[model samples]
Target: MKLENKKVVVTGSEGFIGSHLVEALIVQGAEVTALVQYNSFNSWGWIDSLEPTVKNSIRVVSGDIREYDNIKKIIKGNDVVFHLAALIAIPYSYQSPMSYIRTNVEGTANVLEASRELNVEKVIHTSTSETYGSALYVPIDEKHPLQGQSPYSASKIGADMLAQSYHLSYELPVATLRPFNTYGPRQSSRAVIPTIISQISSGKKIIDLGDVTPTRDFSYVKDTVNAFLKVAESDLSIGKIMNAGSGKEISIGQLFYTICKLMGANVELNIEQQRIRPANSEVNRLLADNRYLKEVTGWESRYSLEDGLIETIRWIDKNINHYKPNIYNV
Candidate 1:
């Protein structure tokens, strides 16, 4: 299961975690093929942010994950496929659930089926904490009942099931990485960390946000990416689903104040109606029991919340122009 000199295909290689994963793979001396969403301009998405040497080392292909034939073609000769391409905005899912179904559920099926046929050595499927909606108990584990509170979560649940079924029914060499609120540089503004940092750095005194009572266990992107490599290298991870997080939870209000303290900005909270999820659909708390990730891959959270937040703020400060502070990113 050594990654050195192995051929790896990373779907959604243009995204926050995906781009970081691609870079990490290059560091492991893997021959990388990065699959970004197709565009006329031939944009590489966040892969464009990679160091020239790392970017040049990877073979970039622009293709939609929803296309089965396209996925099969790109994945045929790949030894490993890290499937991450998806429509992730929760609010946007409310507006367009079908798109989520197509990209998340069907796209995952494409990855699993194609990987099975090609006999790829590994398939790293991405899952989310949202599938466990509002934590039934503190420090949620892999055994928790999945509750699809939103279309986004529902779509992910379907995708996760497909990945697991592939392993059980067909013995596909697949592992699922379930992350709790991964935040860092290059994360989209639709995410909470970036939203807070962008708004504060933009000098907005009144911060418009959704429900602040919900707590999240945040994992730094670097730590999460490292875990992906660990999972890929371990035979113990095959046919298993694991969690990644700091094992600590923070309320959104607390997170906001922490960011403000670091940025030295005094801000008032203005809860916006449009930004809030339906009351019934909102996940009030999320805390990860990340023991399984440790058991399988010897992974643990490497960055403290404040340390990660500070780094994120520094990144957002430099990339402030990319965000529209007053608008709801969804």
Candidate 2:
């Protein structure tokens, strides 16, 4: 299923990855409809910052994913649905777990049911490495036992299950694309990459962070977006949960130091208590075994970690005013 001239609806299109995916789909000649969460401010998040031509190319709608009728309506005519909407912050999830359940679990059900009803050609359900929790072994694969160490991850696990069940029970043409830490220009400070870059770019010599010992397999946003397109286009991806990552891991401390080296900043790290996850809840390591996705879609990680970080740093530096270095984003 080539994306050219296909009608695509991207849920959470206002967000970091969603905005980038929307732009990519438009470039691929897909008719795009962007579904941003409703807000009175009429804000489109990162979509609002896109190039005028890119921003104007797609249709944008505001609605809640939790609303079945609304989602069904917006998704009715689209050939492909990329479901990326969810409450993603782990810390915030501790404070409000029910919200995560409603938005992530119930919301995903809405997408699956609506897609089944509409007979959409494909539904690319988004999953996170967080659902795998701390890796029990290096280079985790699709068969790894899911351990939800946090409420946010637990909610995602539920959502992933729904996507898988929908495929088995109803033969919904759905596939779950589980991506390891994705970072790029439009990422908010809630993520570590942006937090580090925003602080250093704001001239902070000492940066506050949490749990630097944990390692993550970070994928550049563009690579992840490519994975989404690949997964949607391949019939081989149907009913499968595939991983996409650089297949490399770096500790947070190492990541921070790398960023400091890249930006030429001598920075002191202060681990803050409030920012730390509960000891048992912390995901200590994550590295992806992306062979299945590569075999299925011929997708590969294009950007090296350093190259991706360099690009992220450049973007955050220019948009430093949009971030608040003093505030802990989560």
Candidate 3:
């Protein structure tokens, strides 16, 4: 299952984590096709920021994931398919649940059906920590019951179930990789890490945030991408659901404080009602149990939380204009 000389298609290569995964596959000597969302402007999202050398190496395919014809065409003849495309903003999901279902669940179905029809060697389906909602126990495992507290999470849960059913009913060579709170460069401002960094770098004395008591297990984007590569390269991961995380929990308040310290910014907390999730929809905590991933693929977190946060802060500082700190990004 060595990736060298293999043909790999990444469905969301224009996204934060997907772009990183595409770069990793290219580094591993794989022939990479980057599937970017189609636009009239032909924007490649985060992939456009890649170095010329790296960007030139990838084949960019622009199409909608929800279109079965487009998916089948792009999936043809590829040895591995990494399905990372989805609508991920939680707040946006509240505003438009149907969009999430179409993109996350139905889009995933398109990938699975295409892979099954094309007989692709491997399919790596992306899952999220949000699928677990608030942890009923410390260090949630793959077997933990899924509780979708938000429309986004619910959509992802449906996607994961679809992947599982494909593996069981059709014998699709699919693996699900659930990542918890991945953060690094190229992440959008909707995420907490980018939100905090953008606001602090804007010279704002008061950081507007929602409930800070919820905790999450954060992993660096590079580490998460590496784990995806490992899962793709390992036959043992077939029909498995694995987690990529640091296995350490940090509350939002604590995380904000750490980021401020790293950026040398003195900021006070300003609880904004608009920034908060609906009371019933908020996930109180998420801590990953990555034991199965370690046992199956020998993948583990490579970066410490502090190191990753510092790197993220530095990236945001340089790319401040890409973010609008004054407005709450839904």
Candidate 4:
């Protein structure tokens, strides 16, 4: 479906990916409504950093996704709903599992229920590769068994199940996009790429990180956003779960060295004990089989790891003040 002039509502509009998706949707000439998490400071998160014209293009709504009434009110009259809001920090999930369950699971139910009642045409539910846990084989496909090794992943798994149920039971036009490690500008410091870049940019010679041996299929943020768009635009994507990734995999240690090389910095690596996940909780490998997504939407990743890293480094360097590199974000 053409997005031009279609009414679109993005649930986590203040977040990194959501902000980018909002901007892209605006570029596509979609009338946008952004639902930012309500805060006392009236902060719009990354949306606050958008250019003046871009910020003015959308109607901004301050509300919580966990509230069904609030979500229903916001979702009314929109052609599509992009549900991206959730409590996503895995480390913090260990400290507060209930928060993850309430926000991720219940918040998604609110979106789905609201969309169903309002008869929204489409809903793109955001998902994570973490739900797959450690890949039992290379190039994990959509059929790969989901293993919830962490509370965060478990909450996402529950959310995914809810989306599937909505699609099957209510025939809601919902599609789940499971994106791999999406790294780029404006990502939170809780993520590894931002964590590493912020520390290195802060003039830290020794970079502190968790297990570097775990391999991940890192899709650039731009590519991931494109996948969202493609999925929403295609009728074939409804009632489907697809993987959006680069199909290539890299170990965190190798990625670190590559970033160091790209930045022209010789940095020592320090594996912080506090940074590592519990033995069984850590996902050792992930690679994506993006054939289904490709077949359905004709989408593929556009950026290489080095190219994406260069862009990320440049953005993080200029916005260094936004990061507290000295503290572990979790």
Candidate 5:
């Protein structure tokens, strides 16, 4: 379970959370390979933001997660594989659901198959709070009912099942690490935190948003990355679903005010119809019960919501130029 000198491959290593994870793995003394999606521009997404020493410590590979042969080649000798790559934009999924299915569902199958065929030590599958949909009960547990309210969440549910099925059917060493609304530096504007911050940072007096009544349990990016590592390092977590969250809930309206208070700005909230999901498709609330994660891996959120928001606000302030506030990011 120790990461020291362990060989690890992280798919989506160029993403917001994935990029941070690569840094953490390096700090933990793990030999790291970062798998970024191949692109002609040769952009490595958020990984490019990493400090030079940390960035240069790891190997970077460019390939599609949907390609089975390429994944097999990368995953063959690694001790663990963290599968985080997927099409995750919810609004875009409505327009292009097939893309989500292929990348989230089928791409996960490719990772599991590679692990099975090549004898990888472990596979860490990334999952979202969206898979649980609205909370029928407060403080949702791993045993809570899963409702896929959107095509994006549905695709993730399919991916989660595929991970579990691999463990049961093929005895693949895999665990699904489910995380709630995680936000921090390097997050895309497609996410609410960056969207709100970008609009505010861009001097927009009126913020366009969808439902503000729904609530969420937000995990800071670092906390989520810690969970990914702790879960993978624990034999008890194998074949199980573990959630990473702050065990707290805040409505979107409350969250907005919190962020604005931190920014010391007064802004008007404008609920745009186009930004709202179909009523039935919207998830109303989510709160995580993280007892099992702590029990198994001694994992708990280290950052308070206010502290994390302060850090995020600072990062976005310096990096706001990367976000386009005039258009809805979805």
Candidate 6:
């Protein structure tokens, strides 16, 4: 499936990864429709930060993804659909699980339903590594038993299942691309990488954090976006559940220290009770097994953690006002 001259609809095209994916799609010569969540302010989220030339090339649509009618309308006449919209904050999910269910689960259902009805040629559904919870074993694969330790993870798991069911029951050309901790520019401070960078860039000596023992497999946003495009273009990926990651792991404590070193900041850690997840709900580790993705889509991570962190820190430094290091973001 060549993306050149193809009409593609990218849901959540205003978000962190979604915005990057939209830019990438345009570069690949796709006629892109970016479906952003509607707001009274007409805010476009990260899409607003994109270069003017790229932003101007996209057709932006504003609507609620949970509405089947809105989704169906946007999905019609598109060659491919990339579903990346969702409520992703773990802390916020704890506060309102129902909101996560509505957006992440039901919203995904709307996209799948629309794709099925319109007979879209391809659909690439985004899944999070968080859905695997703490790895019962290292190098977690698609066969790993999913454990929804947090409401956010649970909601993603629900979305992934819905995508799979659509493929199995209706023979929809859908694939689930589960990506590990994707970080880079335009990432909100709610995520760990941005949280640390925002605080250090703010010249804070004391960085507030939750438990830092938990480890994660991180991937750069660009690499993750490339994997999505590759999966969408590869006929071999249809009906497959694949992983996209660096196949490496780093603990939160170590990652924080590394960031401090990179930024030349001498920051001390302050354990904040409020920042911690419910003890039982915290996922202690995540490591990705991306062998299948490499074999099927011929995709591999291009950015190392250190290199990606450097780029992210640079972006956060220039856009310091976008983040409030003093407040807990979510």
Per-residue lDDT tens digits for candidate 2, residues 212-323, read: 9999999999999999999999999999999999999999999999999999998899999999999999999999999999999999899999999999999999999899
At residue 126, give the lDDT of candidate 6: 93
Candidate 5 backbone overlaps, count: 0
Task: Please provide, for model 1 over 134-196, each residue's C-alpha lDDT reduced to its tens digit, 9 standing for 90 to 100.
Answer: 888888999999999999999999999999999999989899999989999999889999998
Count clashes in each candidate, considering only residues at least 3 apart in sequence or on different chains: 0, 0, 0, 0, 0, 0
Best by lDDT: 2
lDDT at 178, model 5: 88
Q: Candidate 4 lDDT, tens digit per residue, 3-111?
A: 9999999988999899999999999999999999999999999899999999999899999999999889999999999999999889999999999999999999999
Each model's TM-score?
0.99, 0.99, 0.99, 0.99, 0.99, 0.99
Query: How many residue pairs of model 1 clash at the backbone?
Result: 0
The 10-residue segment with the lowest total lDDT in model 6: 42-51
Q: Which run of 10 residues does model 4 get worst, by summed lDDT?
A: 258-267
Total colliding residue pairs, candidate 2:
0
Give per-residue lDDT, candidate 6, residue 181: 92
TM-score for candidate 4: 0.99
For residues 1-330, write the lDDT of model 3, one tens digit per residue: 999999999998999999999888888999999999999998999899998989999999999999999899999989999999999999999999999999999999999999999999999999999999999997999989999899999999999999999999999999999999999998998999999999989889999999999998999999999899889989999999998888999999999998888888877999999989999999998999999999999997889998988888888889999999999899
**RMSD of each candidate?**
0.8, 0.6, 0.7, 0.6, 0.8, 0.7
Per-residue lDDT tens digits for candidate 5, residues 11-41, read 9999999999999999999999999999999
Per-residue lDDT over 52-98 for candidate 6, one digit per residue giving the tens place of the 0 to 100 score: 99999999999999999989999889989999999999999989999
Q: RMSD of candidate 5 to the true fold? A: 0.8
Cα lDDT, model 6, residue 21? 97
lDDT of 3: 0.94
TM-score of 1: 0.99
What TM-score does candidate 5 get on C-alpha atoms? 0.99
